[model samples]
Target: MAADPTHRAIEAVFRIERARLIATLARMTRDVDRAEELAQEALLSALTEWPKSGVPDRPGAWLTAAAKRRLIDGARHQSMLERKHAEIARERDAETDMSAEAIEAARDDPLGDELLGLIFAACHPVVSPEARAALTLRLVGGLTVEEIARAFLSSEAAIAARITRAKKAIAKAGVAFEVPRGAELRARLGSVLEVVYLIFNEGYAATAGPSLVRPPLCAEAQRLARILAGLMPEQPEVVGLLALVEIQASRLAARADVDGRFVPLTEQNRARWDQLLIRRGLNALDRAEALGGTDGAYVLQAALAACHARARSAESTDWARISALYDRLAEVVPSPVVELNRAVAHSMAFGPEAGLRLVDDIANAALLRNYAPLPAARGDFLFRAGRTGEARAEFEAAAALAANERERDFLLARAAACAP
Candidate 1:
């Protein structure tokens, strides 16, 4: 069955306005869960009434008003509870004197600092990193629990439990719904940025999905990163993250084939890449560097991307410089993923044999046991070195382990090409 046009329009508007809607409601109600519920209630009202009444001049404002009414109704019910009836009644009386028009005015404040405040609050230190990320994506990115679960390669039940526990933790710890200040702001903002980038990276590469890219998630993360960059233009890391995502996303068009099969960087069509986005990324990188942030992870990653952007062809790429940048990035971040990427740079800088050696070492390391890319990289190197039979086996193994259908097909095709 086809979806109603009105419903689709409401969904689109809600996706764009969801963060602000929830933020304003959370500020008023002081309960994240209730704010979400009220927002959903407003959405239901829109679906019911908008068709006959037609879309409003300000759909967001209309939704905000409906959600506020729902909140007021819920508060009235709370006033009847025996445990804190007196306090609830007093608060209700105070709220009665405040007109909905005034409340709507408050919600419509163009500054939207509340949205940023909500981001920091959702990513507060009281919650675990995983929980913080889950909640932020749910509340800010407007992603469903199932979508996040798919991104994390986990079950929907597990993601649901994690979000529940996160909310409980926030309430138990009495986390405030305001933004942090000074040094605390800096620290907490890093977690927020990490969550945003994690979502973008998942969408960009889709570690476990049928498609090579989830363009919606990438676009959403880029939007959030751009918002953050605008909100805090002085922050170097904010600029760095924006630069990194912009550059990476510029290559999305050429990252896959017409049939949705994966295309490695060396084989991608450079003309299909978005040069406008590349220029924006370079400008953002310049801003970060001008602010004296040189060695940060995102900044370094952007620098690596710039190397590719500058090259007219695969052979023209500055492999040595990329290897050096990877060296710096590995030192700063020091993760298995960074090391894996550094190996690729080394391979490009030297020879397939040099890359094979690095891949071999990583293969034996217990950490990459379930990582499909290790074998995939090895297969590519072997294929380039004229070891077709060995490459075929490796490619088949990679295809078997890969979760994404597009990547699996690419590997399978490569393996078939080596057939006798």
Candidate 2:
């Protein structure tokens, strides 16, 4: 049976409000797991009540209030500490008694600090770095375990266990659930940025879905980047990350066709790209350079993206400059993935032979063994070099490894095109 419209609306509201609600509840409960449960309880309450009486004018506030009341009740029943119970009761009563207009205004509040704190907490050093990304996506990006699993190419069970362990580790370590300051902020910022970038990359090209793009996920990551930039205006890397996502997001419109077919960056219509985002990204990039973040990993990546943004057409792209930026990026943050990308840039700047040689050098790297993009990129170079048989084989291998349906289809089509 089709889901009721009311229920669908409630689901949509919950998905949008979930991260904020959990952040607020985490503040109140001082326990991430409890906060999540409380948020779910609020969602269940909304599903039950919203249909009975039309949805509230401010559903987010209504959900927050519901969660707060549940918190108060749970505290009253479980905590023998009168001080805790009284504190919970007072907070609940204060918010629940607010005038509708005041409640609306409160809801309109930026969620700047609260959400940022939750993000930092989720990415705390106490959690394993991989787990940190998964947890941050869950708590701050409002992604589900299944979605996160797909993003990471892991099983749902593994992702769930990783998140559970991360929460437990944070609780046991008594990690502060507040944004760090001074040197501590700088120390913690890298992990936080890593998580945000992971979220954006997943949305930019989803790992396992019918659709090539997940707009909501991309928007959430972009919003998080902007929030981080605001909270740490002096941090050049943070600003660079904001710039990177802005420039990359500008291409979302042209990344796919009206029929939802994948469009390679070189083939995407430049006019469809959002000029406003490109301008914002360039302005932010200038700010990063002014702040002396010219060599930062994100800044280098942003510069690479800027190369494309500045190009009037694919033929006009400064591939040589992009290759140089990727060289600098690899120096700042060396990895097989960076090498693979660098190869592509070298090919564009030089020739298919140059790129193919680079790809062959890393073909044996364990990290790229099952990574579809490795073979897929190599296939492109080989095809351009007129090695159609080898290119077809590589494309088939990439298609076999692809998890996203759309990406797999694109790879298979490339394989077919290479047939004699």
In terms of lDDT, which candidate is strongest? 2
Clashing residue pairs in candidate 1, if any?
none
Per-structure clash totals for the candidates: 0, 0
TM-score of each: 0.82, 0.77
lDDT of 2 by residue, 1-420 (tens): 128887888889888888878877787678999999999999999889988987888788888878877887887776576687777666765666654456557656564566777888999888887898789878877778888887666899999999999999998988766778889988999889987887788889887778888877788789889878987788899999999999999999999888788899999999999999999999999999999999999999999999999999999999999999998888899899999999999999999998998888889999998999999999999999999999999999999999888888889999999967
- Report residue 416 deviation for candidate 1 (angstroms): 4.8
TM-score of candidate 2 relative to the true fold: 0.77
Instruction: Please identify model 1 stretches exceeding 4 Å from their true place.
Output: 1-16, 41-73, 80-101, 104-111, 124-134, 143-162, 360-363, 382-393, 415-420
